[model samples]
Target chain A: MIQVENLTKHFGPVRAVDGIDFHVGEGEVVGFLGPNGAGKSTTIRMLTCFLPPTAGSARVAGYDIYRDSLQVRSQVGYLPETVPLYPEMRVREFLRFRAALKGVSPRKARNARVEEVMDLCGVREVARKLVGHISRGYRQRVGLAEALVAEPPILILDEPTSGLDPNQRRKVKDLVRRLGEKRTVLFSSHILAEVEQVCSRVIIIHQGRIVGEGTREELVHRLAGGRRLLVQADGPAAELQAFVGGLPGCSEPRITGSQGDFTRVEASLEGEEDPRVRIYTWARERGKLLKELALAEPTLEEIFARLTLSPAFQEGEAGEEESP
Target chain B: MKRVLVVALRELLAFFLSPMAYVIGFLFVFFRGWETLALAKSFADSGQDLNAFPMLYAMGLCGQMMAVLAPPLLTMRLFAEEKRTGSLELLMTAPVKDWEVVLGKWAASLVFFMVLWAPTVLLLLLLQAPWLLGAHLAAGPIFTVHLWVLLAGGLFLAVGLFCSSLTQNQLIASISALVIINLLLWGPFIVARAGWVPAEGIWRELFSQVYILDHIQSSFGLGLIDTAHVWFYLSTTALFLFLTVRSVESRRWV
Candidate 1:
């Protein structure tokens, strides 16, 4: 559970995180999506109490980040953009140190916690190996394991899957999904597809401002009006364009390309009717062959780009003007 | 206290595990032992009494050496290593209080320094046993000198740890610590010779006699514990430890 109110962080002339507010309820998996220099990491650091907010306040796990930072930190597990690790320490030793640092009581429980997190993060195999000697993927897992050592109720991970391979990325995503089932998990990433796959809700930020925040479908619908159809035919390009363009309620069809026997046409349609049916009927009567006809919906990536680039989504207008 | 012990134990274990601690210990013992023996031999040849002053002087030098060398090795990794490797965030975000982390790191370096002194105890015991076995050995005075040396060494270690906390570069930390300790050790003589301060004044008293070496020499060389000297070492240690804590706390704001 986290509540951020008008949070802003300014570094001299640059506002890294402008006045923006958002909340993630308990057990919710929220993904923070932004391109490079979108102030996502700065936001994460502020929420974690690692950096003092130049203005505004954030309460993490019901504790004020500024007034009760220690409590907030105790309850929230943070994995910074670059997970800092002591290379000389063994995996178990490092985890043990973190356990002690977090003030986890009872000697037996500490040991159990170390073992539990080691297994939970799939780091049991390299428990005895030196942290420095491990691979990047394993090191990231160790970082996550350290965060989970105390079993904090909330997790704030900055680019958790940044440097992992495909398999490792999948593993991390699965781990986050599983963890999010019981705890509040807020992870930041620039990879749209990764966030789409694991995050239930997404918040898109750009230039120190929140540009868009919603479910995938809501965001797509809000940014992209509706779906359109892409059609390619085996006929003269001009004839196909004129035929599709003459259809009522259809915008002028743009001839995409004509290579040998195929001519591709892109048109903006008005309603939800299957444009393929109309195209097929027209092609049959016109003695033309239809090569491909498919409906194309806007993706999360396109929505993200549009929202971030929109003039209304500037930093000063972040929380003042809500977009859908 | 338990957190402090945890950190101290890890630091001590790391010191022993690495070659740096052994190398420093061997060098300390070898050089200090050679200097003490050589001085004793010269005194014996000259038919002078076996005074403890030369031994105190040698120990003071050893204290300065430990002060200059041990800290960078022990402390360079205190905050700098964490910042470099990103473990500092883990420590800072943990439930532990800022003071706990600071004290833990300080205690760790102190324990390591104490272990470095453990071998020197053998030298003291050897020097005491030979004279104690014979009549009129005056073991109390010799032991008193040894305690003074240990106190001075502890003060140096504390100052070194404080300096180490100021920077992340090992070399920079070590060099700055060396310069500071050297200034503190040689400051009295420089001030006394400069004659800039008026004689029989507070300025002269503060600058000429404020250094640790003079205070330590008066107590250990004379085989007496001056409350002022004890207080001086304790207060200096407290001041540096406090500074270390502040330096560490300020890092979070950055």
Candidate 2:
């Protein structure tokens, strides 16, 4: 469990993490979504007590990050972005060292925990190889095992799937998903799909501030203003666009594509309205063959783009006043 | 204390696995052996007594130079390489304290420093062999010289670790440590030899206090256990270790 309040970090003239607030409850997997240099890593570092917050405070596992950094660190398992490791150490030896460093227990218990996490992270096969000699995927899995060696209840992984191939990414994502079933996981990523598939709740941060926070469907529904209709008919592009634009509750109808005698048209509709009947009647009266008619579903990527890149979100609350 | 040992053990393991440690160790043994043979040849040719066995072996120019050179090489990678490879993040975030990390690394390097000198123990034995006249070496002075070697190496290794903590560049760490160690070791000797300070004044007293060569030969190198010299080595070593811990903690703020 983690509670943060107005956590801020400034590197001289640059505000790496501006005033931001968020909470991660126990046994919940929260995805921290942001682009590069978006204060995601900075916030995670602060939570792990690796960096002291410049202005605000945070607490982990009921311990204050400033006064109880050691306790806070002990309570959380951290996988840093680059997955730092001693190249000379063997994989199993490195995990044992990490386990001891985390104060696992007597030698026997430490080795057992190390072995368990090594298996949990799927690093058992490469346990004897030198860390430098292993592939990147195993190195990442080793990093994960190192984090889990102590069996900390909270997991703070910064870009756990970064720099991995698609297969490795999928594997790591599944691992995180399974691990999150029992522990609180706060993982940062620029990949929306990864977060969508793995996290139950997502927080979008941009320019050092939180832009949006909710479940995937909640974010999509809240930010994607209206429903869209896609209609394909055998007609002139301009005429089809005009006809769709003239429909009740329809606006911004545009010709999206055309081929041979078929043309595709799209339009945004107001709430709770299905204009398929009206469009079918119009097409029948105009002697036009209607090929397709359906409402388009908005993806998380589109909702993220609207929240992060739109001028309304750019000026933050200031641009909200200008938006209808 | 347990955390400190854990960190120290890991560092010791890393040191043993590194090629640089072997290269430095081989050079130290090779050059020290060469110097000891030359000293033995000169004593034999002049028909002089070899009562100065410990001083020749332990306080020789080659031994002194290695003290200055090997520490920086051993400690340069202690913190600098961790920073360069981003391992310092995981290390700092671990449950261990900053002082634990600093002390652990310094202790490991000091242990390696002592290990590098282990072959000299055998060389000391070989000097007392029957073919070499079975010279009766004074054990008291020999013990003092070995103690001085440990204390002096501890201080220099602390300085090197401090320098390593200041930068991520291993070359810069080694070069800076070398400069500082040279200033501490040779600076007073050069000044006093040049006759720049008054013969009997506060400046001379100050120079005498810091003159490590004088301390080694006149006190620790002999059978005398000067608490002042011991305190000098210990207090300065502590000062550097403290500074290294502060430097490590400062990384979080930066």
Candidate 3:
């Protein structure tokens, strides 16, 4: 339900979000992946109408971000990076205030909406407590509750689980996954595993541009190229390396780690070759013991690093987030 | 309009729930009470005319000092705190117009300013009740002083709101508001007493238009409902609120 075309933002001479084009279909759970200072927050601000675009345009929920900002804002619920809240207000009070601010009409419906979100985000226990005195995890959940209070059709959450503990992070991920089933979800994060688990589609941005975008398998197969081999053997390291080195279509096998009685080595294999079978056969012929042999596809984290760390994308990446 | 009320109500709660609001209110009341008591005692001791009571009590140096300082306390945190705490982003992204948020905040501060001075006005009316019972007190002076205070409060608080909108630092907002209100409050007095330039010309007329002492303070104190002075106070208030709206709107770019 969001369309961004050549969307760009600049702070003085610094280009925070360069010309970028992307679209998020309705009911799609899309993860926006980018490292720090990668213009993720800037992009979210533009879509939510908190910041006007310096150039180009974005349409959120079928409303122009610049021309019809109020309408777009009403249709989209945004949880900013820091979860800004009035600390003196109680959790329920803040959610009620947000419900009214977001145009949740009818006295009954407004109260119902507040209660529904409080229950949905699991903040009912601390509804009566002041927001400032709550723990960080509860505060984050309250922020989420505020976003859901209006029952908007679209959600744009910037770093939904930035500072939460591991358990809280898992809870937030589960919450996002559940919410994405019924609503269009676009959340930004630098965490790879959670995004892979929760999002159906992923967009990798670097230096204000989209460096990679696709499903997890597509990215791993396309951007990361062929498969990689992880071999843990209990034998002479020299013989293993020599054997793996002589195998055809296998690049140089490099020892990755050593622990206990096993030496782990990894190598990139070209084409549709079963290197594990060859390693086993070669080990049997050489009378050496093989402890482990497993083939693993490159993960999203590796692909993300490779795509973002390329020399082409590192030019504008070093600068800090500008004033805007 | 409902959206405006949402913002306004939140502000009201923020103000009334905080201990600092009550502290500021108590201080304002104490100052006005002391001013009234001390001025009344001076009039009775010196055998000065009692007819000048309301004028001296509400429009004298004491009143001027309180008017200059009281509004900053109510307005220092209005917009500056929102900016500093990053809640302004939440406000702008909500389904409310920029002007609605501005007007809501302005209305809430104006209400709090009224709450601060309500007791003082009530006390004056109470003191005059015996005279009114005797038909010895004309209502004109009381009405005039009341109008002047109301309009003056609106104008000064508007200036403070504008100053708060200009910065993210509460101290800076308060100090700048103090400086600005002082300039507005003391402008006409300085100009009228100065021996510079012309005795009666464009400069003098320009100062008189906004001169609170000679025009607003004096005219309204005598129960003279001058339309021009009323317009002057109202338009000044409107100008500051308009500036607050513009300042808030400009933040979306940054």
Candidate 4:
């Protein structure tokens, strides 16, 4: 539902969103993961038509962003990073206002749509309360409801669960996941775990460019060299490191740290192997106690770090180089 | 047109809920009342006839009151509050056109100012009490004169809305509106004293009596319906509203 090509937005001397390109298919929930000042919000703003791009082009639902901004805006629902709202307005009143602003016709239908979205976001009980009187979590929910009041096909939410508690965050995440079942969802967030939990695919961005984009498993397999392990031993740190280093398929072991009587070791295996059992048996025979041994699968956070830190991850090809 | 009405309705509702509208309305009534009562006392003390001139003078005072006071309070939050609260993004990104938003906001403030003038209609009615109750008292042309004042008040509100759209700081918006309104109201007096424009026929006509206050005082104060004067107020309103639309649209690009 969204196609961005060579999209670059420059703010005077600083390129806030440098020539990045990506697309989210219909009914796909794609998480935009980036650190602060990584151009996530800028990209979303350009897509939402709040800020015009300095160069390049984008298309939303087949409407050119530059040529058909009104159509693009009408087709998408945007929840800004700050969750702007009128504090004096009640939840229902605010949603009604948003519905009217979004061009919803027939007053009764507008109110019904507002009610539906409010109920969908689980904010129907407090619909009568002024937004200013509500808690942050509820206010975020209200913001979401306002965005959905128009019933736009695509949703662009920036930091949707930024300030919510764990339960509220889970509720919003689940709601987004459910919504993504039938609509396109593009959300930007700095929280890696939140993205991993709800996003079917992830796009990692840094310094105004997308560094990597793929499914969680695909990214882990691509970035990580298969089997890796972390071993903790109740023995001398040097002895544990030397023994693990000498094992087959195990690279040089690095002493992670010492906790109580146990020493932590991180080592990369050469190939897919059940090296944990062999390490355990060797430690038991040598009279060196093994406290814990677990295979370390690559995580989104690690992939993100590797992509951003690698010298090969150039800015120009960061976003457009991959798809899936 | 629907978007305009929706925005207008929301703004009007906000005006009734807020205290600023009430304060402006109360000040308008109090000042006009004081001026009328003072004129009545002066006529009584001098043993002169109470005529349309006294009511005209009071109407002029009303025009000055709105010119100085109404604009700042009414237009201070036109675009400033939205920018401050970050709702400008939502409005700008919506499908509604820029001109629609500008016109809607301008019309809303103008409507609020007009509602504030509603109480003045009662004041006009009260001013006609003597003529209605007593046979010896003469009716004055205050009603017609006050209509001109209302027109001038609408112009001020429109100009104020434009000024408010220029800035995101409420204090700055209010102060800018006050300065622009003052310049338009007193500009002729300053130019006449300084002799900046030629005191000849066409030049004098073009520059001297073209000030808002001069036209308003002449047309409304004398109960005269001049098409030029009406067009002047309307054109000024349209120009400001157009500028407001451009300013709002430029924000999307910036």
Candidate 5:
């Protein structure tokens, strides 16, 4: 579990992480989405107690990050962005060292935990290879095993799949997804699709502040404004626009695409309701056949763009997309 | 304490695996053996006071130069390499205190320092064997030499670790350690020998206090255990290690 309140960090003249607030519950996988230099790494560093917040505070696993850093560190596993590993150490040796460093008690237990996490991250095959000699994908897996060696209840991984191949990326996503079922995972990534596929809730950050935070559907629906409707009808484009304009709770009808037999128009309802029934009755009365009519929500990519680029968002709409 | 031991053991493991440790060791032994044999040959030919071990203590001056060279080699990679490679983040974020990391690293380097000098223990045995074989010799000089060697070795390692902690560049760390160790070891000797200041009064005492050559010869050269000299070496070790811890902690904040 994690709770942050107005968390801020400034590096001299640069505000690496501006005032921000968010929470992550147990067993929830939260994706921290941001472009490079967007303070995502800075935020994770503060949570992991690697960097002291210049202002505000945070708590991880119920322990204050500033005051109880050791306890927080012990409770959460961290994988840094570059995965700093001792190049000369073998994969298994490094994990064992990490296990011991994380306070996995007793030699036997530490070794067993190292073995388990190696298997979990699928690094068993390269256990004896020097970390420097291993491929990038295998090295990333080794980093994951190191993070999981202590069996911490929470994992804070900064770009876990940054340099991996597509196959490796998919494998890491699957691992994160499976791990999230039993542990809290907060992983940062610039890849929107990775965040979408692996995270239940996403936190979008830009310019050192949180621009948006919510589930995918919530963000999409909030930005999409009203229920988006796509109507394809067997009629002229101008007639379809007229029909949409004449119907109640319908306006802004514009034909987006057209075929020989049907024309497609994108329209939306005016209020918290659908206009399918009104459109259907109006179509029957007008002697017009409706080919298709469906409500659609905005995509995560579009919502992300709108949230990060909009002038309203720039003025600070922090936590504006949280679910009601 | 347990965490410190874990880190320290890991540090030792890394040092043993590194080539720098062995290279420095070989050089120390090679040069040290040459110096020791020359001392023995001088005593044998001149038929001077054998018990005084003037040449042995003189060889200690050579050992001290080696001390300056050896520690920087062993210590260059301690903190500097960690920072360069970024593993320092892992070490700092682990459930270990800043003091523990500094102390652990210093302790490991000190251990390697001792290992580099461990071969000298055999040399001491061979040199002292004459007494064991019934030749007339005093054990006092042997004990004194060992004492000065231990104290001076510790001071060198501490200085070396402190230099290592100041930068992420290993070459810079090594070079800085060399300069600092030389200044500390021979700075007073240079000033005293240059004859720029009064030979008597408080300045002489001040010079003797820092003149490692004087400290080694005054306390152990005469077989006297001066608590002040002991305190000097011990306090210097503590001071540098404390500074190293502060340097490491400031790194986390910045």
Candidate 6:
């Protein structure tokens, strides 16, 4: 329900968000993956009408971000990166206030919606406490509750689980998954695992531009090119590498780690085939012990690093820092 | 309008819940009461009539001093604190209009300003009650004088709100507002008294028009509702508030 076309934002001469184009379909859970200072927050801010883009335009929920900002804002609920909240207000009271500020009406429905989101976000226990007195986990959940209070059709959450403990992170991830089932969700994060688990589609942004975009499997298969085999054997390292490299559909093996006489090596496999059985059978025939032989899936982390850490991206980051 | 009231109600609730507002209210009542009683004692000792009482009390040095000092303190945190804490992002992204946020804050501060003045005005009125064995008081001058206070206080608070919008530092906001209020309240009087402008010309007439002391002492202090002075307070308050709204809008740009 969001359309962005050639959107750019500049803080003076620093281009926080360069010209970028992307669209999020209705009910699609899109993960905006980018490292810090990659313009993720700036893009979300422009979409939410929090910051006007320096050039280009966007339409959120069928409303122009510039000409119909109020309509777009009413349709979208945004949780900023830092989760800004009034410290003096109680959680319930704060949500109620946000409800009103978002034009939640009938008073009774507003209160009911606030209560519902409080329960949905698991913030009912801390509802009576002052926001400042609550822990960070509670604060983050309260920020989520505030966004859901108005029952908007679209959600733009910027790093929703950035500072939470593992348990809290899982809880928020699950909540986001559940929320995305009914509403369009565009969440940004640098955490590869979280995005891998939560988002249906991933868009990787680097240096204010979209560097990679696809499903997790598509990205892995496209960038990784082949499957990986993790092999551990108690044998001479050079001979073991030569043997594994000579196998069918297996490329040259690289020694990855070691423990005593056991050497851990990883080999890239070319075609769709189970090489585990072949490796084990061949090692037994050759009078060599195979400690471990398993096919391992390439992780999103590796793919993300390969895509985002290009030499050009690093040089651009260095140049940006040195310019001003 | 409804959204404006919603924003205003939140700000009003914050002020009431803070200990600082109570402290300010107590200090204002205590000091203004003491000053009133002290002035009354002086008048009685000199055998001067009570007819000049409301005029002196309303346009007196202490009233003007409080006017200059209290509003900046009340309005300093209105925008600056929000900016510092990053809550302005949440506030601005809401479905409400920019002017609504500005007006809501200004409205809340104006309400609290009235709250601060209520007890003092009640005390002054109480002194005129029959049970206190006090003189018969004319209602017109008393009402007009307090109206002047409200208008002048509104202008001062608007200036403070504008200053608060320009920075994220609360101290800077309060200090700058104090400077501007002091200048607005006393600048014309000082310039005219020092004969900086020509004595008899359009420049001198313009000085008189802008002179707050003349507006207070000759107009509001004597219960005359000079439309020019009323327009002056209103238009200046609007000007500052409009500037504040612009300042708030400028946040999206930079």
List TM-score per model, in order: 0.90, 0.93, 0.91, 0.90, 0.91, 0.92
Candidate 4 similarity to native, TM-score: 0.90
Local error of candidate 3 at B170, Å? 0.9
Candidate 3 residue spans exceeding 4 A from truth: A224-226, A232-249, A255-265, A270-290, A312-324, B129-136, B196-205
lDDT of 5 by residue, B136-209 (tens): 55667667767777787788888888888889998999899889888887787787778865868998666677
Native contact share for candidate 4: 0.64
> Over 4 Å off in model 4, which ranges?
A231-250, A255-265, A269-293, A308-324, B41-51, B54-63, B131-143, B199-202
Can you write out model 4's per-residue Cα lDDT over A16-68, one digit (the tens) per residue? Answer: 99888888999899999988899999999889888889988899999988789
Q: Spell out the clash pairs found in candidate 2.
A: none
DockQ of 1: 0.55
Q: Assess candidate 5 and give its lDDT.
A: 0.83
Per-residue lDDT, model 5, residue B242, is 89
> A54-91, model 1: which lDDT tens digit per residue?
89888988899888988998898888888888777889
Model 5: residues >4 Å from true position, as ranges?
A224-227, A245-251, A268-294, A319-324, B52-62, B128-139, B196-206, B252-254
Q: Candidate 4 chain B: worst 10 consecutive residues by lDDT?
A: B131-140
Error of 4 at B215 (Å): 1.6
Worst 10 residues of 3 chain A by lDDT: A315-324
Q: Which of 1 and 4 is ahead in lDDT?
A: 4
Scored by Cα lDDT, where does model 1 land?
Answer: 0.76
Q: What is candidate 2's CAPRI-style docking category based on DockQ?
A: medium
Q: Which pairs of residues collide in candidate 4? A: none
Give the clash count for each candidate: 3, 0, 0, 0, 0, 0
Off by over 4 Å in 1: A233-252, A259-262, A268-290, A307-324, B53-60, B129-137, B196-209, B252-254
